[model samples]
Target: MLKKYSATPYVIWSILFIVIPLILIVTYSLSTKNPINGQLVFSFSNYRKFLELKFINVLLKSVTLAFKATIICIILGYPMAMILSKMEAKLQKKLIVLFILPMWMNFLMRTYAWMVILGKNGFINKLLSMVGLNLNLLYTRGAVLLGMVYNFLPFMVLPIFTVLLKIDNNYIEAAEDLGADKLTVFRKIIFPLSMPGLISGITMVFMPAVSTFVISNLLGGGKEVLIGNLIEQQFLVLNNWNFGSALSVILMIFILVFMAFINKFDKDNDDKGGVGLW
Candidate 1:
């Protein structure tokens, strides 16, 4: 009885914060402001408006950029995790801490730091100028992608490292004893076992990349705008609460659907024993 009641505070907190806010967003999304008397009326016009081509293009660009970042993170992070997993346990802990230390700082600050590094007169450009080569490094899609990767790479690496550490060395040894090469053993055993972590990393990296306004705003410089920027403009700048709520609802749905798809795909791959070494 005491344990059950102990959860009451948490339940109340969730209701007050999470549930109520979600309810308000939904209500606002399905309503419209009256043109004549300034009253809110129940309507689907907000959602309907999102079907326009401009909004659809914004959504597509957001997804494409996020996907690119997630892919890059996986490619870079997997090797780093593998290397870390092979290190001495003591050294691994220190290196992991070092990797995570940057994350302890405010993310906004981190993004701003990148602005200094990537700006036209920034460190990279100055270094290149000394070598008699000048490059435009800032306020571009590549710069935004770099920021996303830098911020989220740790999310990818940590999960994969954890999974790799948990894997039994016996599996690899057994494969070797059966005359399998290192590549074969990894393909058959290590890679398959690490799928759960990889999936988690993808989710961690992709979701933030998809919804990020700050990195785009700072690195992309007004030239690049994402769905998140659009939503922010609708709410704070345009004062179209109903439309903003509708966009928020759409973004939430996209995230949910993507997560569901990833979950299903992970399960399917697991059932099939992942990629076959043969």
Candidate 2:
């Protein structure tokens, strides 16, 4: 009976930190300042402003870059995860630490370091110039995408690795005994089972990639504006909390909808794998 009260603190914390802050954001997003009386009045003006062409372009660019980064992470991370999951238990632990080492560093510092490496006079360009070749590398959309991939790769890898590890070897063995080839087994069994992890990794990487301002601000040299940068400008530079909150609310909605779509996809994939593989 006493143990039932243990959740009370968590409930209180959620209400205070999560629920209250969300309530405040929603309130601000739906209200605009009245110039005559200097008070907030209910309005859809902020959301309407978001539908403008400039903001729409920013949102599309942010989504496109995020999608590119997420796809790259999947291509790179899935193989790393597969390799890690197949290793000996002792070696797997060591490798996971290695994979996670960079993540321990400050996120801001990691992005700043990228700026140094990608700058015109930085590492890559310097090496290229020595060979009588020079290329513009920094402050481009490619730089932002690279930054996103580097920072968020581990988030994609770890989840998928965990899922692959949890998959029973018996499933693979059964599939092999039933005359299934490696590709067939993977298609019908391994990949389907790993969908949960893949989706989780997507959620982890995409959420941050889509909304990150630091990577774009630093690697993009402020010329490329993402939804996050827009929101930051509204709140910090323009002193327009209402518009910032509105953008945030929309971002939240996008995330929620994406998660719903991923969940449905995962569920549908679950039904696709039957006893034929076994």
Candidate 3:
């Protein structure tokens, strides 16, 4: 009876949410525009338009920004995770709360806060002017990158911290017992052990960074458009639902391909065994 109930809910959800919408999106993608009535006609021109240079440029820009954000998160988050893992229990809990507190605030509110700090007349610029320095941050690509990093840092940190905590301390002790230096232990043992978390954190940061349009629009000052922006424009401004749907399909396909690549490359490791280093 329990098994039947669980399976029934899954079937209902799949049909109502996932499967049905996917079918509609696919159907929409393989469609064209009707000049006479300004309606979507059943054809393939939408996909053809999606394959054009302008849309391709937007996709490329989005992917590049996402990659940059993921790298920044790894560089910054790994150290923070390491510090948190090494601290005392009371301090660790406090720090973890501090790290996650920002996420509790509304995302748009946090983003707007950054705008206040980085805008021409904002905090940073005002401080610089007081000291005879000047900087232009608002409506720039750098501002967009900063916003992505600020927003996604918690997602990157939480997964990595979880993995770090699960690591066997015996490994570090054994490495030291065998005269292995701290760097050696970290390079050979700790890093490899944290691969799953690292992979997951990368996915968490990359996917949203690439798909986010609001940050690019508000921080990037409409100059740094991404694939998401293009899709939104297609749907709203151009009134081309078919083209927007096609672009969404392409974006989903791209994410699926990247996930497949990560899974394929990381398939060799099995972390069930708890062997200490050295």
Question: What's the lDDT for residue 2 in model 3?
Answer: 90
Where is model 3 more than 4 Å wrong at Cα? 37-40, 271-278
lDDT of 3 by residue, 1-278 (tens): 99887799889999999999999888888887778997767887777776765578788889999999999999999999899999999999998888888888999999999989997788998889988988988998899999999999888988888888889898889989999998999988888887777878888999999999999989998899999898889888998778889999999999999999886545644444432221
Per-candidate TM equals: 0.94, 0.95, 0.93
Candidate 1 C-alpha lDDT tens digits along 130-220: 9898788888999999999999999999989888888888888899999999899989889988888899899999999999998899999
Residue-level lDDT of model 2, residues 195-267, one tens digit each, is 8789889989999999999999999999989999999999999999999999999999988998899879877
Full ranking by lDDT: 1, 2, 3
- Displacement of residue 28 (Cα, Å) in model 1 is 1.0
- As for lDDT, the candidate ahead, 2 or 3, is 2
* Candidate 3 local Cα displacement, residue 230, angstroms: 0.4
Model 1 stretches astray by more than 4 angstroms: 269-278
Q: CA shift at 179, candidate 2, in angstroms?
A: 1.6
